[model samples]
Target: MTPPILTVRDLVVTFGTREGVLTAVNGVSFDLYLGEVLGLVGESGSGKSVTGLAILGLIDPPGQIARGSITLDGAELIGKPEEELRALRGKRLAMIFQDPMTTLNPVLRIDTQMIEAIQAHERVSGKAARERARQALARVGIPSPEERLDAYPHQFSGGMRQRVAIAIALLHRPAVLVADEPTTALDVTIQAQILAEVQSLAAETGTAMLWITHDLSVIAGFADRIAVMYAGRIVETGSVVDVLETPIHPYTAGLIGSVPSRNKRGVPLAQIPGMTPSLAKLPPGCPFSPRCPRATVTCRTTMPAETPFAGARMARCHHPLTGEPLAA
Candidate 1:
């Protein structure tokens, strides 16, 4: 097996609020192999985005990475100085955020932003950097790259803006890309195009991607492996086929069953009961016990250790759901 391009182990992120310190990520760990797309799927507030931010060392004031190490190509990123981390961003590791509107500077021309990004890490003439930026824009399927580069961020359509943001991230051909809901705001056609471009880029460049989103359909089609997170912890993880087709954790099954297309026509949607609890007031034992149908007294009384399953799959549950057993 190829050594992992990005490896995060036992990561924990906590935020300090007026109320108290709230844990956003708890003991999260995963490995992204070269050229592989690893999907982190869970509902909002499940810590999926927080995990990505923590990995990138983007957790700002009031939030902190309390534990764990993020290794990029065998280099430990945890506790690294901000100056060193800044150099790594975009050049070695890059991220495409959910909102392109906020990501780009309104006053800066697309060319200026992209050129600055390029020249920041590599010593290059303005002409060479501009050429690289234009090529990147073209690579991301933008038309008239030279003209587009001169346009301000506000002039571009939502989908186009996203493409521009993505193009900027790809300028350096970073070793790993942490894309947090990069297609959430685009139309279906645009979404498909972006996904295809991302897929192709990873294949050609061997850039490991951590594709974070709450959209299971996207994960089904794009992710090589899926990690199901809930209440700040990874509750289940396995190959995409195994996990999506035959989810073992109750929460995982609930998410799959709740998808609109999977339900019987005209029937009410099957939603997992109750809401995700607040991080500051998480329940004892299994964080998901409140909503898990298969949960038992044991589940509510003590946290379940991650149990190994067939095919390197694992689930943190006292009573793992064997889909068939529930049907019977």
Candidate 2:
């Protein structure tokens, strides 16, 4: 079997706050294969975005990747020097933020930024790199790419700018791409287009992508697999069909229930009972126990280890759900 393009094991990210050390991502693990999109789904503060930053070595001061392994193409990245990680970031790995402005410079023209991005990793001529930049823009469905490249980031609308960001992230055809809710802020129509573009591009370029989002519906048609995260940990993971159709974790079921469905018309939209638990003070047992409907005494006192079910399916729940998924 071909090895995964990216592997993350027991990833723990922490920050030192006035209240003390807070673990944003606790013992999260997953794998990303070439051309596969893994949807990391969870609500705000679930640490999905933090996981992406940790993988990219972008966690700033007070924030650190505490004890774990992040490997890209079999090379360990967890303890590598900043210089080494920087060298690999754009060439072997890349990231796209939720906001295009986070990846773009307001003052720079799109062409200049794209050309510079290409040049930063490869020793290509200016004209050659510029042409590549134009091609990338076109690949993302940006019409008049040649002319659009000459404009500044401000000149482009939100959706168009996000396409530019996606174009830049794919410029190197990196082995892995971590997208942290890149489409969350766009309208439904634009979000669908962006999702389609990204899905097709990943297939075309053979780039393994970690797409982070809280929307189950958004991930349903976009990802090959889903990793349901809660309270800084992955509660369940499996193929999109299996996980969505038969989620074993209560948290996963709750998230699915929250999504609007045609079958649920006129029924009150289901909702998870409690708010996300605080990372600074997670429960001693399952981090999600407080919010989990199926949690028991064991679930409230002892953390459940990853329990494997049939064929690559796993969930961190003592009382895993069986049969059909929640009827949302």
Candidate 3:
């Protein structure tokens, strides 16, 4: 098997709150291989976004990576100085945030920002950088790339701004890309277009990508593997087919069942019973026990270890719903 491009082991992120130190990411682990897309799925407040931020060394004050390790191409990222991590960020690792404005400079013309991004890591001339940036815009299907380059972030529509942000992220062909729901705000047509472009770029550049979203349907056709998270931990992981078809963890099953395509016509949507537990005050045993229907005495008191299955799948549950026919 090929070596993984990125490996995260036992990652733990924490936030200092008035109540206490909240464990936002608890012992999360996964590997991303070159040219592969791994979908990280979970509900809001599940620490999905925090995991991505931890990998990129972007966690700010009051939030820190409390434990574990993030390795990129065999290099340790934990405890690396800000300057060092910043150097690696846009050149070797890049992130596409959910909001384009978070990435684009509202005060600067698009060309100025893209040129600076390229010049930050390379010794390319302004003319060369501008050419590359123009091509990137064209690659993402922007019309009149040359003309658009002269415009500011505020000039473009929301969808267009997102495409520009995506174009900037691809400028370096970084080894790994963490895209945090970058297309969620766009219309379905634009979303589909961006997904295809991103998929193709990863394949062409051999970029390892971690695409984080709450929608399983969006990932069903995009990612090579799926990792389902709940309460800051990865509860189930496997190939898209394996996990989607035979989801072992109760939470994974619940999420899959909730998709509109799996429900009967005119039937109410299936949903998990309760809200996600507070990370600051998670239960002693399984954090998900309160919402899990399969929870037993043991599940409510002792957290289960990850159980490995065939096809490189694994789930953390005392009473996994394996071998059961999933709702169609």
TM-score for each predicted model, relative to the true structure: 0.96, 0.96, 0.96
Q: Clashing residue pairs in candidate 1, if any?
A: none
For model 1, residues 284-321, the per-residue Cα lDDT tens digits are: 89999999888889888899777778877888877777
Q: Rate the local accuracy (lDDT) of all candidates.
A: 0.90, 0.89, 0.90
lDDT at 58 for candidate 2? 94
State, as a TM-score between 0 and 1, how close model 1 is to the true structure: 0.96
Q: Model 1 has how many clashing residue pairs?
A: 0
Q: Over the stretch 121-232, how does candidate 2's per-residue lDDT look in tens digits?
A: 8899999999999999999999999999899998888999999999999999888999999988899899999998888898888998999998889889889999999888
Clashes of 2: 0
Instruction: Tell me model 2's lDDT, rounded to 2 decimals.
Output: 0.89
- The candidate maximizing lDDT is 3
* Alpha-carbon shift of residue 38 in model 3 (angstroms): 0.3
Off by over 4 Å in 1: 323-328
Q: Candidate 3 residues 38-148, lDDT tens each? A: 999999999999999999999997998999999998999999988999899889999998876566878999999999999999999999999999999998889999999
What is the alpha-carbon lDDT of model 3 when measured against the actual structure? 0.90
